[model samples]
Target: MASRSSSAAAIGRAARSSGLPRRNRRRVRRLCNMAGPDLMKTKLYSVSPPVKAKATNASLSGPTRYSPGMSTSRGRASRHKKTFPVPPAPREFQQARSRATYERILAAALELYAEQGFHATQTPDIAERAGMSVGGLYRYFRDKHQIFRELVHRGLEQNRQAQDRMLAAAEAGLVAGETDLHRAIEGVVDWTWKALHPTPPDLLRTLAAMAYLDPAFAELTEQYDRYERKALSRLLAKLTSRKRVPSPLAAARLLDLVVPNVGIWTALHPDEARGVKEATVEMIYRYLADPPE
Candidate 1:
């Protein structure tokens, strides 16, 4: 803890001496502090693999970032919209042993979901991975779906927090040092690509399958989209020079839908990723930046 604080303070001092615009410098200091250590490795927005049957591993790196801005408006509005069918964990998390058991189950489930996809990963598989009996697992979770639901919630929340941080940074006037639309889009693609890295293809496919079984999962997705679209719309309005945009809300919707799938797809098939990455950037850039009819 002391070392981490010292590192943040050192970065803060460096920013103070740097010739960057005062506002920009201040933003940098804030980001460094928010990120704590390993600033460069931390992505602008690290979206977990598409709802991972795994939805997401809550262990994704770096601290969550958000600020007072358009990025959080809809997020705040839809925060309470979804209701879980099962309690995330019926066990008391306050006890050390109980908390450890709960986390073990989740970690085990996340691994199995990645390896086998959501449907194929049974309670037994999770219990085996967690080194617990099936009956033991049930004491913490009523069923596997409940565990899945909890993971999806954690993953989505993590992704949302990262997205808000990225947008907030952008809104704070950090543009990845690009002014042109295509370059900006490329940078965006690159950042997302790095963040996604790789996720099992089967996990990517499981999002739809899981959504069917649990309407709550679908509801959570809808809620996220609503918040994401609004935030993206605000970003488009601010960044674009043209007075008229090609339905900024529509464009945001497209990105909010497309980016995760595209990311996961590319991660599993790196040979095809370059083409997909370019295509995604072009499609999104035109959708967001092109002049209105």
Candidate 2:
């Protein structure tokens, strides 16, 4: 108990030094205490598809470095190049009732995180929003950060699934020799643009803030960023008439990272949105169409 209290206090101090407001400091402290001191001392790795472990902060000395699928997290155990040695046991709920409650908490947290801002929203707020008590909420997640991480993971997975479907259609069209590669590229960009349309600016800002403030969150975003870029690269590889672009990844990066981010802001102005999309689409298609020396 003494050690745990000390760990929580240390985290609280870190939170304060990190410029978190009073309310959020309390929330951070509570979360640390709930997870216990061992949570900080533990070094994390990807366990399986859904379950993951925590990254070490052993002395709260530095930011946690996150490793996504098949990447090295920290030290190399051996020259075997194996990651996730000794897979960690799963943590997700197995029971139907628990699963329902768990989802309810995530659903409520998703709304509250955007509506109230992640820092401003407390665990109690999430519980209340989910029609549960603080104690019940604790049963599922140790802290709000855990909930945020889960939300991001699930969102990224959903996006990858969507991309898979889109790619499948494009590939099927290619097999039939009916796919206009340029048109398929435009469709992909348009799909990405529309996906961002309904999300309020507040949520986007919230995501940006989280990524800025938390190393783990930043790493989580980067993992998906890598995936999306690769997915874009795969699209171009299928084009038989494609020129020999010196760097295919560069082209992929522009479409995956640049277009959608810039396009989202253009959407803020409803009248100009259509024009901006057309201009951006043309820019992306042209960039991919021609190879740079």
Candidate 3:
């Protein structure tokens, strides 16, 4: 009975040893199946090396190395970081723009000065109305008077242009030998009267005020008045010579009556000038249009 028992024990031990290898092989096969087809196509009993912690961390630290889905997210972040470019300014401009700006500023200042009167209108007010800096305004003009001087110069030039045209027309009539001296006198009177009446009332008043306010300005005013008289006297002389009108000097003096009186009356009493303008025009007409007896 002891011998039989020993043989049975040896057989049992061999069966146990044989079954252990088969069970381990089946576990490895299932693991390869879970790893997918790439692992399956390789050696069925193959064993890979264990991953090192340092190598895994080094891969994560590098720029290119990333997890399965993380590479796409990082690429998107890189694309978003790119910046858009900006545009540049122009290289050059002309002095014409500056001249235009100056003219605009001057016009705005004049219109404001005319509306409010010079003393009441401020430089800052002019700058604001002109859409310019007050500092910039001073750079161009020293004071309101300087700006006024420019305005006066411009106005005088405009007046001179108009007078030239009118004189041309008058001279043409003379060359045609316009026979009726009375009709010619009436035509001259009308033309001269219209020209005098068109001077801006506020600018004229401001000039008159300057004579009383500033002695230096009063001298400048005298010079301009002299220039005006000379111009008028020259033109009147031409008119008198053309007509062969008798007492030519006296007739020229009569022609000069409208301007000085209007200016003087306006300076002394502005309200009175409105009334005198019409009356004076009539008076001059009567004197000039009448035939010498």
Error in Å for residue 9 of model 2: 36
Sliding window of 10 residues with minimal summed lDDT for model 3: 53-62
Instruction: Give the per-residue Cα lDDT of candidate 2 at 206.
Output: 84
Clashing pairs in 1: 51-55, 52-55
Candidate 3 per-residue lDDT, tens place, 67-185, comes to 32244555445433322122122224368787777787788878886777777777788888889999988867766655665665565455556766765666677678762444555
Q: Model 1: how far is 205 from its true place, Å?
A: 1.6
Model 2 over residues 1-293: C-alpha lDDT tens digits? 78877777667667677554577667667776677788767663112232233444311112234543223434222212222112133457778899899889999998997787887888899999999999999888877767776777677677777877887888788889888757777778777876677776777778867667755566556777787788777767776334555565677786777776765676566678888777877776666664545
- What order do candidates take by lDDT, descending? 2, 1, 3
Candidates, ranked, TM-score: 2, 1, 3
Q: In model 2, what lDDT does residue 27 have?
A: 69
lDDT of 2 at 85: 19
lDDT of 1: 0.67
Q: Can you give the TM-score per candidate against the true fold?
A: 0.61, 0.66, 0.51
lDDT to native, each model = 0.67, 0.68, 0.55
Candidate 3: what lDDT?
0.55
